[model samples]
Target: MAPQTWLITGSSSGLGTAIAETVLRAGHKVIATARNPIKAAQENPQIEELGGQWLKLDVTSPDTTKTVKDAICQAGGSIDVVVNNAAYSLIGSIEDMTESEIETQFSTNVFGPVRVLKGVLPFMRAQKSGTVVNISSIAGLDGLPSCAMYAGSKFAVEGMSESLSKELKSFGIRVILVEPGLFRTKFFSTFVEPAAGLNQDYIGTPLGDTLQHFKDLDGKQNGDPIKAAQRILEVVTCTGLGVGTEDMLRLPLGPDCFDRFQTKCDALQENLTMMKKIAYSTSY
Candidate 1:
């Protein structure tokens, strides 16, 4: 495969860092962006040492979208792949989460990707070929208790990616939604907790139980970030990773993700079967 230039956001740690390293090792050019480039270099020196460039980018900043586009133009004429991997998890029940908290979550997870896409799409359109990889989660497909805010953000990304895939197909741009189940990354450690003023009545309910369950699953997740990164690279390069064909839109990373997706599909099929006659009669 020919070498391609990849621009990955939130490349300081976790899957982003792993993906950046994987791309560099594969002989591809990587432009890794983080909110604090200095800190990123301090944390992962291998990124610069291994031939990847670093850029300071906070996706929530008003000027960041234009800055990223300009930076890409200055570094290289065009980028072949754009990875929207910058996002953090916000865990809490719907009622427990404040409007501010929910807005901030959407700002980072949903609007951040939108900004990157808006900046990169013009270049991709002009180049006539490009790939967009959006990092989502299994929560996007099936909402879990106490994960309503995070799930809402991911669900938005999934829906947007679906629309973009069709919209940009004629321009030779492909959109890939990566729904990872539970990777052993800094995700749990850095996840945002619920705000103050908790309702005492709901402390021991199912939502509370779910919150505790998430805490217990933090360091015990079965998936590996490095392996997940390798698989993502393989999928983007069309290397036949046993998951699906090259044109597949959604790539679920872990075994847990695959199982959850299958269950969702089965449930959907069952519901459709039960409502087939009513739906058909209404359509006419």
Candidate 2:
């Protein structure tokens, strides 16, 4: 494959930073976007040192589209791949979550990617080739006890990506949903925002237990961000692990994500088999 230009969101740290570094090291041009490029570069000096260009972007803001277009213009009006990786988790039970918190979660996780896509699709459509990689979570496939809003946001991304894969195929645009399990990222530590206060009624329930589990699993997650980033690059470039299998819609990273994905498929299959009669009965 030829050297491609990659535009990645939230490239300050975690998976985004890893992906930017990996892409740059692979001899590709990377336009890494973050809320504060100067601060992000200060923290992760290797990004710019590796020749990754930093662009100021905040996915949650309406200005995201303009920033993306400006970056595209600055990059000679061409963008080959876009990785939508900017998101934060709002962990808490449905009953314990506030309206504001839910809005914030969707604005960042769901709408953020949409905003970026809107800006880049025109150029991609003209080029008739591109890839859109959405960084979702295993929670998107299976709702957990204490991850209502976060799961909801990822679920939206999953649905949108699936539909977009079909919608964009005719235009030579590929959509991939990267469903990752717990990776050793600040996702669990600095990025995971808990609800304002836990509801006393659910403190002794599974929701509380789930919250505790996240705390315990913070730094001990089994997935490696570096390997995950490499796999993503390979998939987008259609090389390495992506060769001979370019039709994959979802790339489940880590053994944990694979196991969970299989479980979800099995459960859905069993339910459909048992409920097919009821489903048909409802059809006119």
* Backbone N/Cα/C clashes per model: 0, 0
Candidate 2: residue 147 Cα off by (Å)? 0.7
List all candidate RMSDs to the true structure.
1.6, 1.2
TM-score for candidate 2: 0.97
Superposed Cα deviation of residue 150, candidate 1 (Å)? 0.6
Instruction: Please name the candidate that would achieve the greatest TM-score relative to the true structure.
Output: 2
**lDDT values for all models:** 0.90, 0.91
Collision pairs in model 2? none
Return the clash pairs for model 1, or none: none
- TM-score of each candidate structure, all chains considered together: 0.95, 0.97
lDDT agreement of model 1 with the native: 0.90
lDDT of 2 by residue, 59-122 (tens): 9999999989999999999999999999999987777667887898899999999999999999
Worst 10 residues of 1 by lDDT: 238-247
